[model samples]
Target chain A: MAKQFKSLHPIKFYRDYLNQNVRPDGRLLSKFRPVIVNTGSIATADGSALVRIGKTTVICGIKAELAQPKAEKPKEGFLICNVDLPPLCSSKFRPGPPSDLAQVTTRFVADLILNSGCIHLRDLCILKEKLVWCLYADLICLDYDGCLIDACLLALLTALKTVKLPSVDYDVAIDKKVVNEDEKKSILIYNTPVSTTYAIFEDKIITDPTAEEEDLSSGLITIVVKEKELCSVHKPGGSPISEEKLYDCIQETIKRADLLNTLINTAISEQTH
Target chain B: MNVIDDNNLLMRKVNCKLDILSRPDGSVLLSQGDTVVIAGVYGPIEVKTQKMLINKASVETFYRPKSGTPGIGDRLYESIIQNICETSLVSALYPRSSIVVIIQEMQNYGGIISCAVNACCFALLNSGIDMKFLVASASCALDDKGVFHLDPDKLLSDKAKANFVFVFDNIAKRIIASHTSGSFNLAQYEEALELCKKACDAIFDFYKTKMKNEIANKV
Candidate 1:
């Protein structure tokens, strides 16, 4: 229930919040939750991380395996993201199967990483198309208080930072054409991206909303960035946002991006130690 | 000739929990060494007419085991989970309504049931009984190459000969629901049950730890 049962009454609460430029959480036009990031939580995974934004907690694990590449992208390695929300995270989520919500969100995250060039695709290449590294980044919600989009992004980044692939030897199987673990490959990484989310409740533009605020919101704006440029923006719902607000959101996200970039680096540094 | 030692492969797991979730009747996470499982119980709520049976409160259960999405989004599989839950639960006491239990396997490897059943028991206990007994556990197992292993990991799961899932009531010491795939021989079936017992006994230790943690935290 990301939307509060306030209407069918008047104007949408989220729209009104955006209009006033005051978020329900009492922040300015732009703000992010107090967040923390860590890594190596799942030692079994090649890379793993746990991220917390306020109360929203997400765990992301990355596993690398050898697989054949597609004919079209034979030179590039494989990347797959499965974003899961177990029912325990929220009362609204039902148990059983993947929801339409999960599918759309996963696409948004994947595109964000793909376009941002967070991973060095060439590093995953092995033996032309016969074998390559298949990276599976699995995101699980431990506690979804709100602003899950942002928390998920943070977790993804943290997991990517810690993920180290086994060293690859293309000549390991010169005759048999099989890659073996006689040696492991160095970790392959490119740049990293951070995602920020905003919820509109009336005129107030709330940043990193709590679950209650999320339900009250009419619409939300998610922004993913790398250094200075924007990687992606995902908006899902009936309510529409204006270009002016979107720009403000972007400008505001710039400031948050710097902070987020710093945090990610610090977390990654701690993880390596 | 070098072979991997079964003892060194890490065989067991445990969890410490308190009342974690706010809305559930009760909840717990059971980990069999990173094969993580979370189970929650909610209900005795008023049931929709179509869902209600004239006699007893229909039990609804949902399972999502990190493999891949199964047939439907929980609506279809809820019945299977509910049946597994009801077999050991005192559903008769909460008649004409519904008791919904949800199980999620987050980090799946193998022997998912061994952990799932344990989590389910902890959640049921937390849901505030209507219990006929103290606890119940369930496990899905397989045996290959005549080696009777308890709680196989993902690597072993791929090579297993049969898939056996059993639900048991700890109070009655009875096997409530035992299901076996066609691959195993009669002797294998007997051996798997014996292994299932070992798995169940291990999971019960997890159940106790969760209870103690919950009690200490008063969560």
Candidate 2:
């Protein structure tokens, strides 16, 4: 049966599918899995979202807590991003502490959030240096199929869109803070940065690979597009790729970003309604 | 002791997916309402010399919280899960090897311990590991008014006077583990146990349905 062939000679099975111009999962080389986004699902957190791309599921929750602003950046607040890839997601990850992949992904997501100017930290400042809203954005991988970075970024962005901070009245002289829970305001997001991951198998470049595909491929490239500009083009040292192929990946990401923007917007609107 | 009504005995909505992760021998993501936990099983593999056992497979558990390093509370959870897995697994079949069950707490609304235990059970089943019997877990909260709330949310749990988590095996529906916090009388504890025991039945049925679907898909 085909299942036996796939398990026994996986490379040959994949090559056979590639020869026919399709993937083992019946997706075209450039086709991506359907992305479904649901926002404000976790009631305990200030903002939360569940994003699913194919079978890879990620949930992001943002908890906004009051904290004193740093001495250097008194006008800005904090946005700490952490991505957890526990052993439950994949067997490659162990049970001890955060693995290298998890730490790298967290740094990448944090860098993206900062460089993209998606959120203005100053907007989070309530009483300048006295008090500010420190948003702790924690991304958890419930299912690890593939395209982990793409799913984590999407979940964080969507969850950030749903964040609502209560109105706080701070008396500077008395240093008293009274929070009005009734009047809540959402955060201001400037740019919507969307990332797309592709696997480079020999000379063929495939987008949104599953876990199996990622392993068989030689290299991986992730293109992050924000509006018409390129936010980041990350290639974590796989096989060498030509400039033209890189440019093509950027173009594909641009198109994908537009579609994702609409998807996020519709999901947020649906949550509000 | 205040008796819980039959209408208040229902658990939260349960959702689960088995074998969702690659690389792991078996994995499961289970959610009870908004409290989600994912568990993976890697077993009958190489064991560290210091921790190796001569007559049975050593069972180990790791509990990862949503964020930051695992604290003392998390370590307690790990041990609780470790004990449950050690007892249920037929480790004598694979001597000198080890079985590791890692549970990641995705979202914690309430009753997270129960969710993690159930998720671990499902992951072990998915790994096709030999076990004495399947286990199911359920939790309930007792408010100040002595009313029992099955599968209480964060708000309810925070306001509760006591909370209880109980695990039962499928073979005899007997208690495999019991964890409780807050102040409560002996009579109240007994009533809470009875309530959770009923809720465990629903969880057991859920596992059966999910396993049947998995087999059907494979066929």
- RMSD for each of the candidates: 20.6, 22.1
lDDT of 2 by residue, A35-140 (tens): 9999998999999999999999999999999999999999999999989998898887889887756776887788778767789999999987799999999999
Q: Model 2, B2-98: lDDT tens per residue? A: 2244656667789999888997889999999899999999988899998898989998888999999986557657766876887688999999999
User: Where does candidate 2 stray beyond 4 Å?
Assistant: B1-219
Native contacts retained by model 1, as a fraction?
Answer: 0.00
Clashes of each: 30, 0
Can you write out model 1's per-residue Cα lDDT over A187-231, one digit (the tens) per residue?
A: 655666777788766545677778877766655666666666555
lDDT minimum window of 10 residues, candidate 1 chain B = B1-10
Candidate No. with top lDDT: 2
The TM-scores of chain A alone, one per candidate, are 0.84, 0.98
- Pairs of residues at least 3 apart in sequence or in different chains that clash in candidate 2: none
Q: Is the docking of candidate 1 incorrect, acceptable, medium or high quality?
A: incorrect
Residue B123, candidate 1: alpha-carbon lDDT: 82
